[model samples]
Target chain A: SQQGEEDPQALSIQEGENATMNCSYKTSINNLQWYRQNSGRGLVHLILIRSNEREKHSGRLRVTLDTSKKSSSLLITASRAADTASYFCATLLRDATNKLIFGTGTLLAVQP
Target chain B: SAVISQKPSRDICQRGTSLTIQCQVDSQVTMMFWYRQQPGQSLTLIATANQGSEATYESGFVIDKFPISRPNLTFSTLTVSNMSPEDSSIYLCSVGAGKTEAFFGQGTRLTVV
Candidate 1:
């Protein structure tokens, strides 16, 4: 079963703009990670934020996690045409099995 | 981080046929997972494949329909049996790395006719 739901199922913007996607979950999680998939192919790992941390950044990507609300958000600053892809947020439950429950996903289209 | 090599990147099969997807990891891992993504949809986990044990399937998925084999820590296979057009989707294999991050293989795009 899917644990999280991402809003703004689809978004369109020109190059150099910023895109923000939100994800809300149902249960407590140990950590949250974001992944990007291009053209329905393989997924590339983006960033991971642990429950102990509220925010993290890597280059143009920023992820914020709020344990109290069981939500997380991904901010992509200075988006490019190459940034057009499907973004997913997956959560790792604080359990023995390291299974990840994925979010619905947000599709971003960056026009050059 | 573990690198995975999945065979048969894409295939077109007829109804009632079966397709087995393979996932091989560079390093031995404790847990591996299989997921299915329908057209323009989110990923749904099919099962958790653990080495030396029978795979544990999720709700709405059965072993008879989607059988999984974890022969070793680094190799696993998922077979879609008695496949129909509804079984057509992107199937991906993943392994959990340190800090609970997942590494995925290039998905297999199955198209059933």
Candidate 2:
């Protein structure tokens, strides 16, 4: 079963625009991580935010986590055509096994 | 970070047949898990492969349909039994240490006809 739900199933934008994706979870989590997957390829780890942390930044990617509301958001700034991919948020629940549960994912298309 | 590899990146099989996907990690890990993702769908965890013990399955999944084997900490296998068209999906293997993020394999794209 999926623990996280991401909004905006698909997004299309011109290059240099920003893209933001949100994820909401049903249970308490130890940590939340974001991933990007190109077509027909394995997922690439983007950033991970622990429950104790409110926000984190990596290169052009920014992630924010709110434990109280059980939600997280990933923001990509100055997006490029190469940044086009499916973004997913995975949650590691505190009560469940150590397995990571992923969301439906948001597909972003950056037109050059 | 651990490097994970899966065999037969993609394959097409007939119905009622079985396909065994292999997952190998570069380093020994304590936890290994299998996940299924249908086209345009979210990932669904199939089971957790524990070395020296039976794999633990998630709800809506059974060992009979998806038999998993963890012969060692560095290697595991998942077999989709009696596959059908509905079984067509990408299967991924992941490994993690404790509460940290997991490393995933490239995934095996299976098409059952």
Candidate 3:
């Protein structure tokens, strides 16, 4: 069973607009990581936020984790057409084995 | 970060046949995992391939259907035995070092007919 659920299964916006995706999980996690996948390729790691951290930033990507709410969000600032892809959130549960539980994912389209 | 590679990028196989997918990492990794992604669905973990030991499968997956082998720290193989059309999906291999996030390989796209 999947532990996380991402909201707004699909989203569309202009190239310069910011795109936000939210994910909610049901279990306590050691870390939550985001990934991007192109049409038929493998996934690329975007960012990871530990349970103890509230927010993190990498380049134009920002991720926030609220342990109290058991949720997280990913914000892509100043998005580009190249940023159009499927985004997924994977959780590594505390004291669990090394496997990650992935969410359903969100498909984002950025029109140029 | 680790660079992982999978063999037979894509294949079309006949039903009742078997196919083995290989995964290789550029550097040594402590843990290797297999996942399946059906069309328009999320990825699901299949099993954990531990070096020189029996693989640990998830609740819905079993060793008889998706047998995994890890002969060393950087290489693992997953064989889909007695495959059927329903087994067609993308198989991905992921590697994780201690305290690091998992890194994925270019998944193997399998099509059973």
Candidate 4:
């Protein structure tokens, strides 16, 4: 089962603008990672924020995690037409095994 | 990070037929998993295939419906049986090693009619 819910289930933005998506989970986690899927196929990993970390950045992608609220957010700055894709947040639970539970995605459409 | 090679990227199959998707990793991995993603939906894990052991299935998933095989640490296969329109989805294979997060492969896009 999916453990997180991401909203603004759909969003539209002009190229060069910023796109922000929020994700919330219901359980404790060891780490939170964000991924981008193109055309519903292979997923490209963007960034991973450990439980102890509050925020992380990779180029234009910024991810923040709030353990107290069990929530996280991804901020993509200067979005491009190529950046248009379904973004998902996946969680690595605090359990002993290494299973990743995914969240309902946010579809971001960047108009060129 | 280990690299994965998955084949049969996309297929259109008839109802009641089955399709087997293969994933081969460049390096040995301890845990390999299978996931299903419906159009415009999140991914749901189906099972964990551990080398030298029987695959462990998650709730709402069973071996008869989605059988998995892990012949070695670097190779695994997932078979979607008795395909239906409802089974049309992207099936992904993932691998995890050490302390890193699980990495995914280019999913197999299945379409059943």
Number of backbone collisions per candidate: 0, 0, 0, 0
Give the poorly placed runs of model 4, Cα more than 4 Å off: none
- Judged by lDDT, which candidate is best? 1
How well does each candidate superpose onto the true structure, as a TM-score?
A: 0.98, 0.97, 0.97, 0.97
Off by over 4 Å in 2: none
The per-prediction i-RMS, to one decimal, reads 1.4, 1.6, 1.6, 1.7
The deviation in Å at residue B29 for candidate 4 is: 0.4
Q: Which docking band does candidate 4 fall into?
A: medium
Q: Compute the lDDT of residue A108 as modeled in candidate 1.
A: 99
Ranking by lDDT: 1, 3, 4, 2
Candidate 4's residue-wise lDDT over A1-112, tens digit each? 9999999899999999999999999999989989899888888888889999999989998999999999999999999999999999999988877889999999999999
**Which candidate's TM-score is highest?**
1
Estimate, for each residue in A1-112, the C-alpha lDDT of model 1 and write its tens digit: 8998998899999999999999999987888999999999989999999999999999999999999999999999999999999999999888877888899999999999
> Of models 2 and 4, which has the larger TM-score?
2
lDDT of 1 at B56: 92
DockQ class, candidate 1: medium
- The alpha-carbon lDDT assigned to residue B41 of candidate 1 equals 93
- Look at candidate 3 and tell me the lDDT of residue A14: 99
lDDT per residue as tens, model 4, B42-103: 99999989999999999999999999999999999999999999999999999872256567
Which 10 consecutive residues of model 4 chain A have the lowest summed lDDT? A39-48
DockQ, structure candidate 4: 0.64
